[model samples]
Target: MEGFVQNTILITGGAGFIGSNLCEYFLGLGNKVVCLDNFSTGHQHNLDGFIENPNFKLIEGDIRNIDDCNLAVKGVDYVLHQAALGSVPRSINDPVTTNDVNVSGFLNMLVASRDEKVKRFVYAASSSTYGDSIGLPKVEDVIGKPLSPYAITKYVNELYAEIFSRTYGLETIGLRYFNVFGRRQDPKGAYAAVIPKFVMQLMKYESPVVNGDGNYSRDFTYIENVIQMNELAMKSQNEGAVNTIYNTAFGERNTLNDLIAYLKKYLSEFDSKIADVEIVYGENRIGDIPHSLASIDKAKNILGYNPKYSLQDGLKEAVSWYWDNLKEK
Candidate 1:
């Protein structure tokens, strides 16, 4: 991160959990950041802390629109493309909207970046790309058939990125994110991620439901580690690093039961009654892989990426943030 030059960066979905964090981080790094979001899944309140900054600009637009993509990428040096309809169940329910945003929107951004001659295009890929592969620790080279529409869309993004890199000479890096969770992640929706959603339920002394017997595991990554990978992908000068995919993860897996235990432990600190909250188990949802763990060796060796947060470390921070910022509401 040292000796990195400041440049104007465009973050699609800049008002969502991860995108908003990127916006705040890059703005703090003395770079001009233009945020483009349609506010469908992204919340406007996520931009509150830094919205007034002169270095930050907000474009109320959607990535599905080519003109909006073009207008946002104009004069931008880097594109952190994170806009997409994310959720296995939601994607199952509405594949069309998911494809329109994840696939078509991604293509629009790539075209805009190529046309604008942006320096690099870093995107938010998903571990769902690993799909039905039963491999314990997933490596970049291998993958299985996608299990859901959401997985299909993310894999398509990677393919499109590689094609754009080869066919258009654009610099691209795809970060295959695992089950990412942290502050500002929405905890209210039916499609809300498990971590934040469970946290909210426990805070209210309600039973947090587990989809299965709670043995399904994931490489739960932290937001800060994700930020690190994005920055490294943008600034990496290594010849072999660009135009490749890297697993942006903590390289460790935890089961849902383990996650619940930690969540209860952390939340109990704020309210002792949270310790008594029960967890309910239901039928396993469709299109869910039994386990997911990342092999980050490629990212570390190629991009010099080192994730600074473990799950417990990040959960502590996330729980604290929710307690202070959201528990009252």
Candidate 2:
């Protein structure tokens, strides 16, 4: 909290789910927040609360444009680079655009932050960067070749961050987020994560199709845990911690069936009929891993990280938010 005082934080994709949460939390702590979002995947409704805040300013700009990146970085003390087109399927369809935005645009942000002399640059990395590596619990040092265009972009992000820190001496931290989910995570999109998608389908009494026999598991992280990681990365004075990456997750895994069961059970609390929704099994998605789990040992030891919400704890809060915020609308 004391770290945010007199700090000006530039959250690149501030209109998106994770970035907006950062904006809200930092603004609450009396920090000046400047949000830059092209709204490619982010929504206008996400900014409804922050737009009116005197401490929060939204920059309606794209990261691909170097001028916009430079402009947003000016007079900023720290940066949380969350801007990028996210979605494996979308990248599969348009690798060029994904590379341009995720890779080239990330370069732009690094350059801007370096030139502007921001104290620290923390970015939203992906667990997909772990790629096709065979391991039960993913560690920071072990990674395999990327399986898809999206994964490649994310892995390249780590490379660029490493290069920037090594060459330009820009302080940096990368949080490899695993299956981040919670409020404002767009469920309407074709590439929506399983949790919110299932929640929406069950709410409408529509059958939620499992991408496989509901056996594929993932480290479903809550948005609040993500926010905590970002804050720790931003504030930590640990010399060894800076310029490194950390796994931002709840340290547990859940199968797709468990996701649906919880969604039905929780949504049923609001509407009893939701519990009756049937789940349909389907083919597993191509390029999707069979299971994913993270070792939070690095984050815990280095960044002083402690995840406050587990998958179930997060789902309860998330379900309530969706019911109150999106269900009625």
Candidate 3:
């Protein structure tokens, strides 16, 4: 069965890495797409290929502006809310800005979508929502106190989304994404993810820094899997689907040390000079979970969510992409 869907989909932050990819997938299926982005954290070049597409409409706007959101959602059928200020370090450094973009911006989008009578409001939640919970496989009902301002914002999103659905009758779905990585994911900047950072470092034949002892484990998800969850969440018709959240991950875990080894091994084939590069370690940053493993049974049984790529498989694809695009540039 087709997922809870409509003819035209409104995707906020449509120029970012995940948003752009979602735009491509939905537009490919002959759906009219309205992409709203302010280009604060997202790049304009990310949506270059789709700007001319007849099914795609680009609105240069910010989610912080309720007027912009209302205008963008006027005739939207489904809403995919992917815009947010990401990174715990960034949030720790500038909590107020993060709260404004992630919390205030999220609430504004929800209100706009509800006012526009959108069919489904799907949002990008974070695994950081799990926060200080020490559970091996995190469940939706179970959560710990948010450790970072960023985590608090995401958890607050879920809370607000739940209330909106109950009071305002807005149907909402949240995808709590794990460590997502893949093509078009930005590798530049201080708060870049470990994979992309390592890939860039390996390209320069430089040692990549490992945070803490490198034993910290994470359920590193691929961008494709994340897109799948978003698609499934938006289209799900089951009554149990709405006003809920799901873990979008591979149901597998990997450590930083292992990830580094994999990157070095795969990247070394392209340039033998990277083979001998050593790794440096530093203290673990605050707001990071010690270990993360997702029980995908909820997503698997409910949404038919099937992640086709393993950690190694996803990394290989990401490594190749970085080698071709990032290295050349």
My TM-score estimates for the predictions, one after another, are 0.99, 0.98, 0.97
| 2 or 3, greater by lDDT | 2
lDDT, residue 315, candidate 3: 89
Clashing pairs in 3: 3-235, 4-235
TM-score of 3: 0.97
What does the lDDT come to for candidate 3? 0.90
- lDDT by residue for model 3 over 48-102, one digit each (tens)? 8788998899999989999999999988889999999999999999999999999
Off by over 4 Å in 2: none
Off by over 4 Å in 1: none
lDDT of 2 by residue, 157-246 (tens): 999999999999999999999999998998887888677787778777889999889999999999999999999999998869999899
Name the runs in model 3 displaced over 4 angstroms.
1-6
Give, for candidate 3, the lowest lDDT window spanning 10 residues: 1-10
- Superposed on all Cα atoms, model 2 deviates from the true structure by an RMSD in Å of 0.9
What local lDDT does model 3 show for residue 16? 88
TM-score of 1: 0.99
